[model samples]
Target: MKQLSLNDIQAAAARLRGKAVVTPLLSNIELNRRAEAEIYIKPENLQHIGAFKFRGAYNRLSQFSEQQRQAGAVAFSSGNHAQGVALAAKMLGMPATIVMPKDAPAVKVAGTKSLGAEIRFYDRWQESREEIAQDISEQTGKVVVPAYDDLDIMAGQGTCGLECVEQLQEMGMTAEVFLCPVGGGGLIAGLSTAVKALVPSVKVLGVEPDLFDDHLHSKKAGSRQKIEGTPESICDALLAPMPGKLTWSVNSRTVDEFLSVTDAEVEEAVRFAFRYLKLVVEPGGAVALAALLSG
Candidate 1:
């Protein structure tokens, strides 16, 4: 896999400017009181489509050539990426077809449908979304946009890190550690690269559900690890069996640590976010907070 350079990240930041929201990095007083360390929440939940996926989705779609854009785009995602791609494709006036698990969250499915993307559903454990997506691509000649593995997507996610660093500077604060939940690794890979580039002193950490901790094992084994079988955690979004090759390369170099949290911990964090933060963070989205609060 080709490595993402600082130039790529900078270009992505430029491409995403004025498109993706520059989400706030607010200190969680309750969290800080408990952790005994100054803790800030990067409320990417407020991002367009209600997740950080918009940065990468818009960045990738916007860079497509006219011909490619005209051909339209297709991708496979469980939830967040689906919504991101759907919204981005709508904004770009390109047709989108999202292959999602049949059991994907109702809100996510509704959100994607609301964005006017055609939905294709398959069994989460028994179906291969890649094959289904390829079939759709062959039939419709749509461009296959990967959820996390692509360089363009990774570069787009780097914009989030850039925003975080800027927010920290403006607040006259520095994060001792930056934690993000990892799945296919796009978000953490981009965030870690940008954070290390801009704030070398800060530690970039990737949090994962213990049931699907391929990233943790991969880092330890010095090779990519793939786990077979369905994830047994409530953090369904972190269920990718292996890290993307491009994501692994970036994360292996720039990420400071990998931490695993239990299903129970994830659930607690989700409830906490809803109860205290008044944020409806899904289980996968709450893993970072799970690590922070449980540690």
Candidate 2:
């Protein structure tokens, strides 16, 4: 496995300059007072497809050889990554096929289809998305766009951290810590790497639903730890079974700690964001904020 570096993230940022949205770091006076700390929200919800998944998707899809792009791309995701790849392929003028859970949010499924991608639904509990994507790629001879385990995908995600640092620097301020929701560990893994490189003292914290703390358990075990039984949460996007191998390699070193929030706490955070910050955050996206509110 290759190690990701600042250079790799910098390269991805260059590629995404005109293509990806530079989401803003928004602040709310009430939120600061409530948390008793200045909390800056890097709203990747403003990104294409309403998530940071677009950053990695566009970065990887746009790098494919012309022949590969024309042949098309295949990916598997419960929601966000599906829409990311679907929308990116459309922007790059390529065909896209996504393997998604039958129980995925209606809005996300509709969003992917809205981008003109073919959808393949599967049983989320009984089936393997990776296996389905592999079969599709073999049948169609299209490249598989991995959700987060790919080198390019992680590097692409690192661009978000790079932007956060630059955005704070421009305001003549420095962050004491950075918090992000952890699913397969892609976003936090890549973002933590970049943030640590730029500001060594800034602690990077990864948050997940208490029932789905794969990263937390993995950190304690010193290896990848898969969730054993059925665990449930309203944060559907944070339910990845385990941290990706590629992402864990970086996260093990870059992240300072993992924090777990209950489903009720996450729900409350979502409500708080809408009421106080006027931001409609998805449950998974609100876990980090939930942790802050917990204390």
Assess each prediction's global lDDT (C-alpha) against the native: 0.88, 0.92
Off by over 4 Å in 1: none
Query: Which candidate wins on TM-score?
Result: 2
Q: Largest lDDT belongs to which candidate?
A: 2
Can you give the lDDT of residue 1 in candidate 2?
A: 63
TM-score of each: 0.96, 0.98
> Residue-wise lDDT of candidate 1 within 1-295, one digit each (tens)?
4688768889988887778888887667788887899888888889999888988888899988898888889999988899999999999999999999988888889999999999999987788999999999999988888889998899888888888888888888776788999999999988888888887899988999998989999989998999887657777677898898888988888887899999999989988888778888878889999998898
What TM-score does prediction 1 earn?
0.96
Q: Score residue 174 of candidate 2 by CA lDDT.
A: 94
Model 1 backbone overlap count: 0
Worst ten-residue run, lDDT, model 2?
Answer: 227-236
Task: Give the per-residue lDDT digits (tens) of candidate 2, residues 1-295.
Answer: 6898888899999999999999999999988998888889998888989999999999899899989987899999989999999989999999999999988999999999999999999998899999999999989888999999988898899999999999999999899999899999988878988988999999999999999999999999999999888878899898998899999998999998999999999989999989988889999999999999987
Candidate 2 similarity to native, TM-score: 0.98
- Candidate 2 pairs with clashing backbones: none
